[model samples]
Target: MAVSGGIAAYKSAELVRLLRKQGAKVRVVMTRSAMQFVSPLTFQALSGNPVHSELLDADEENSMGHINLVRWADVLVIAPATANTLAKCSHGLADDLLSTLYLAATCPVYVAPAMNQAMWHKTVTQENIQKLKSHGVIIIGPEQGDQACGETGFGRMSEPLAICNRLMDETPTRCLSGLKVLISAGPTREPLDPVRYITNRSSGKMGYALANAALKAGAKVTLVSGPVMLSPPVNADLISVETAAQMHAAIIGKAPAHDIYIGAAAVADYSPMITEQGKIKKQDDQTTLTLTLQKTRDILAEVAQLVNRPFTVGFAAETHDLEQYAKDKLTRKNLDMIAANWVGRDLGGFDSEQNALQVFWKNGQKNLAMTDKNQLAEQLISLIAERREYERGNKNTA
Candidate 1:
């Protein structure tokens, strides 16, 4: 494991401990800056091996530590991969031990990024992440939450347990190989005027998680996204749209070419009947103003109704009558599956980092309890793949 400089570097210690507990021989390599936050002795104690950080030493193996380390390792994991480290690796700069080892290693690589939220969101940083992904590097969570910098967003390294579980799990099966998956995400705005619009609390986290999970499961992914602050996953074909009408056109136009469609976007139910040419004038005397609303296109329902349509899944977020409403939509829209969850509660809903789902199909249902959106996404994707295979088997037998 490579530990880069970040406050999250301390977490890498626990990650090392967990990997040792999982019965894996461990080696740790650190950046110079990382040594400032955590001592090399700490890692050496936990890993039961010497920690390596120097690019050049008169010590052993002819001063070719980078080459020897790569030969002995089956996998390379870089935790708390700082922006500097990421940029260096993406651009093939091997001036240090960790970066040099990254170049020489022939093993599968995983990176868990850590930095301030702003740095993580920078266009250049995201582009570097894309370059790494294109080279087959698996990205673990830079999960959203409190940061050491007293700011909260998506730059925190994932918890050690989550990282350990992800690494220990067998490599993801290529179950959806040779299939196309279409996903919609985020909230669609319905313009009330040039300056104002209607939208929901959807953060697009769940949808984005699903897209990433699909990509890991060996599917060709096309993501139709509404306006969102999050970065798009690398390698997925992306189409960005804002308003409900535009989202509708994008999804419907692309739906036929895909084999599975997940309507995870929180599209507006209604839009203004008329958009003012300019911002509505405000008057000191004006107490209230009313405008007409027209129903927006039902993107999920329409896609489900397409001839020989892809297996379709929909999401329902509700505050009351959750099961009844979810089942009703599942039947009314002729959906193959629906994942419903509660909103307006204190936990696991829009804008939050975690979520839960009560998933239903025609004759069965499963409850996916509250968890990180990314983990929940993997479960959902596995279920979708299983159901699709079952449906195909039935058709062949019939």
Candidate 2:
């Protein structure tokens, strides 16, 4: 573990403890400035190893310390990676011990950034992050929440447990291996005219995250996505669609072949019954214009009612009565599960980077706390896998 200089450095102590509790052999590497927030003795005692703090220690340097350290590591994790450290890494500045190790290390590098919300949102910092990711660095998070700076935004380090789990490879188990997953994502456009269309604020982040999570769990993933600015996961087969009808058709054609179906799209419930071929002209004295509407296809309900249906999941983004609406949707659609969240809130759901879920099944539910969509997706996928396995086991016993 490499600790950088940031207020979040304090969290590294708990992170080290979690890593050790998971049976990992840990070593402490602190930058010169990191020693300000936390004492080196604290980490050394927890890790039960000598703390490496200098690039010019005669004893360690004579033994080719940096190169040796790089060779000895299976993975190098940087928690509380400050903006300065990120900048140094992106530009390949080896002026400091941690940056030097980052440059020399052949092992996988995982960085968890921590800084003020404004600093995190700076264009330069975002560009630096892109550069690091381009070099195969696995960026864990700077999750959105209360920061030490008394501001709430996207500059806090992830929880110690989450970081520790990744370090120990304790999560993201490949339990869904050999299964095929079909998912729909984004907001389907309902056209009003040639130039105008109605769509929701769905950003497709959640669905894309789920698709990626399923792929990581060794599932063959097919993603049917609506128009969105996000890139598709490289491992998943992506089929792009515009309108809700197109998405419905795409899913119906592929749903039979998959073992799981997750309808994550915020598909338009109603489309204009009559779409004008050209842009509607402005009238000289028009006060109101109305258009008839027709219900779009119920993709989830259709798939759930199939004679040989897959394990079906639906998503509900509600503004009020969240639980009631979600449970009602689950029963009405005959779905195996439904993940619901309240949209139009400051915290999560609908084009936000974070989300919480109230997942409902027949007789039980799980409330997932708000966090990064990626992490939430992993948790949701794991739960679905477990539920599916239990159902299979019950059938066998019966």
Report lDDT per candidate: 0.90, 0.88
Question: What TM-score would each prediction reach against the true structure?
Answer: 0.69, 0.68
Clashing pairs in 1: none
lDDT of 1 by residue, 205-235 (tens): 8898888778778799999999988767756
- Angstrom error at residue 153, model 2: 18
lDDT for each residue of candidate 2 in 1-398, tens digit (9 for 90 to 100): 89999889999999989888888788888997899999999999899989998876678747567777777876789998999999999888999789998988655578999999999999999999976754446688889999877899999999899898776673356778899999999999999999999898999989988987787677999999999887677568999999999999999999999999999999999999999999998898998898899999899999999988999999999889999999999999999999999988786988787899999999999999998787788899999999999888988999
Error of 1 at 13 (Å): 14
State the local distance difference test value for candidate 2.
Answer: 0.88
lDDT of 1 at 255: 90
Task: Tell me the deviation in Å of residue 294 in model 2.
Answer: 0.7
